[model samples]
Target: MSAPKVLVVLTSHDKLGDTGKPTGWYLSEFAHPYDVLNSASVSLTVASPRGGLSPVDPSSIDAAKDDSISTNFINSPSTKPLFEQTLPLSDFVGNPSAIAPFAAIFFPGGHGPMFDLATDPQSQQLIREFWDAGKVVAAVCHGPAALVNVKLADGSHLLKGRKVTGFTNEEEDMVQLSKFMPFMLEDKLKEAVGPEGAFEKAPSAWGEKVVVDAEGRLITGQNPASATGVGKAILKAISS
Candidate 1:
C-alpha cells in the first residue's frame, strides 16, 4: 500500500483584524506538524486559499527560534519552498477526482485562518467534501475556526455532538489578542458544536492538547504546542 497522503492547508490572510499587524500561519503550528508527518514518510501537499505565497506570522518567527524543527523549516531549502506557492483550495472543490488522492486535510493556525479560512466558501465546501468522503479532518489552534460554519448534507453543523479543542479563550486573553480576533475561537467552537458537543482545554493556558474524535474522522490541537501531537494523531488515525 502507498503512504497516506495529507493535504496541509495554511492561511493566506496576512493582516491581523484591524490591528495592522502582520499575521499568517504560525511557524511552529505548521512546521512541527509537517516535520512529524513528513518524517513518518507521509506524503504531504501544501495549499492555501489564494494559491500563492502564504505569509508567516512575524511574531511566531521570533518565538519559533526556540524550536529547532520550526527554525529549520523556515530556513531549509527543501521545506521553505512549500509556502512560496501553495495550491488554491478551489482546485479541489467540485472536483472529486482532485481530492481523491489525499487521505486527510490539515489546517495550521496563526490567527490568520480566523479571518479567511473561517469564512471562505470554497474552504467550507472542500471540508464538507472531505468529511463526506469519511476522510480525516484536522486543525490546530485557530485553524478550527474553519469548521465553525461547516454543515453536513443533512443540514446539521459538522461539529455538532463532537468533542473538539482549539485555541481557548483563556489563551487568547493571555496573549492579549482577544480584542483583535473577529471572534473568540473557544466561544465559536462551543457554539458550533452545540450542547451535545464538548469543547475541552488543557489544565493550563498554552498547554498542549490534542483531541482525536477518530470515530468522527476529526482531530484538533489546542495551540502551537499541540501541533506535533496532532500530526502523530493523524498518522495513527490514517494507519488504523
Candidate 2:
C-alpha cells in the first residue's frame, strides 16, 4: 500500500474584524492535519487562492495556548516547509490535471477563508471535480463555506441533503467574529436547505465534530479545534 496523496489548501487573506490585524490560516488548522497525515508519510501539497507563503495567524503559535498537535507541528521541520512553499491559485485556475492525482483534498481555515474561499468559483469547480471523481473532500472551520454555492452536474446543491459539519453560527458568536464574517455560514446552510437539511454541528466549540455524510463524500469540521478529527476521518474514508 502506497502513501496517500493529499492536497491541503489554506487561505491567503490577512485581516479579521475591523482591527486590521493580520489573520491568515489558523496554525492549528494546518498543523493538526499535517501531523496526522505526515505520520503516514502522505504526499501533501499546500495551495491557496493566491498562494505564495500563505500567512498564518501569529496567535496560533503561542505554545501555552494551543493544542498539542499545533505545538508539535510548529516544532516539526517537514511540516513547516508547507508554510514556506505553497502553490499559487493561478497554478490551478483551469482545473489543472495535477489535482486529479490526489486522493483527497482538505481546506484549512481561519477568518481568511471567510473572505475569499467561500465564494471562489474556480476553487469550487476544483472541489466539484474531486467530488465527482468520488474523492474525499474535507474542510474545517470556515473552510466549509466554500461549498455554499457548489452545484453538481445534475444542478443540485452539493450539500443539499448531506449531514455535514462546519463552523457553526453559535461558535462564530463565541469567537465574536459573527459580524466580521462575510455571511453567517450556519444560517446560510439552513436558509439554503431549510429545516430538514442535514447540517449538524458539535455540542461545544472545542469538541471535535466531524461528519461524513452518507450521501456524498463530504466531510466538515466545526472549527479550528476539529481540524485533526476531520483529517482523521478523511484518511479513514480513503484507507477504508
Candidate 3:
C-alpha cells in the first residue's frame, strides 16, 4: 500500500499582535511532529495561507535549542525546505480534488496562527473540506484557533460536540502573552465545541496532553510538549 499523505499547515504571520515581537509557528510543535511522522514514512505536504516562506517564531528557536530533533529540523536540508517554500492554502480552496489525495490535515501552532489561520476563509474552507471528506483533522497549541471558525456544510461548527484540547489559559498566562492574543484558546475551543463537547487540559501548565476524538476524526495536542504524541496519534488514526 502507498504511504499516507498528510497536509501540514503553518502560519504565514510573523508578528505578534501589537507587541512588535516576532512570532510564527512554534519550532518544537512543528519539528517534533514532523520528525515523528517523517520517521514513520508518512508523506507530508507543508502549506500556509500566503504560501512562500513560513516564518519560525524566534522565541521557539531559543526555547527548543536543546531539543535535538528541533535543532535538526532547522539544520537538516530535507526538512528545512518544507516550511521554507510552502504551497499556498489558496491552492486547495475551491478545489476539493486538490486535497483529496491527503489522508489527514495538521495545523501546528504559534501565536501567529491565532491571527491568520483563525480567521482565514481559505483555511476554514480547506479544513471543512477535509472534515466533510471524513479525513483526520489535527492541530496543536494555538493551532486549534483555525477550527474555532470552521463550520460544516450544515452550518454547524465543525468542532461542535467533539472532544478537543489546545494550549490552556494557564499556559498562556505563564507565557505572559495572553494579553496579546486575540482570544483565549481554551475558551474559544470550548465555545466552538459547544456544551456537549469537552475541552480538556493537562494537570499542569505545559504538561503533555493529546486528545483524539476518533468519531470526529480529530486529534489535538495541548502544548508543544504534546506535539510528538499528536503526530503518533495521527499516524495511528490514518494507518488504521
Error of 1 at 12 (Å): 0.8
Q: 2-30, model 1: which lDDT tens digit per residue? A: 88899888899999989899999999988
lDDT of every model, 2 decimals: 0.92, 0.77, 0.93
Per-residue CA lDDT of model 2 for 121-204, tens digit only, reads: 777887888888888888888888777878877998878766777788888898787877779888777655555567787776
Model 2: how far residue 96 lies from native, Å: 5.6
Q: Residues 1-240, candidate 3, lDDT per residue (tens digit)? A: 899999999999999999899999999999988888899999999999999999999999999889999999988998888999999998998898899889999999999999999999999999999988899999999999999999989999988999999999999999899999999999999999899999999888889999999663899999999999998999999888
Where is model 2 more than 4 Å wrong at Cα?
A: 63-68, 93-96, 194-196
**TM per candidate:** 0.98, 0.90, 0.98
Q: Which ten residues in a row have the lowest lDDT in candidate 2?
A: 59-68
Clashing pairs in 2: none
Where is model 1 more than 4 Å wrong at Cα?
Answer: 214-216
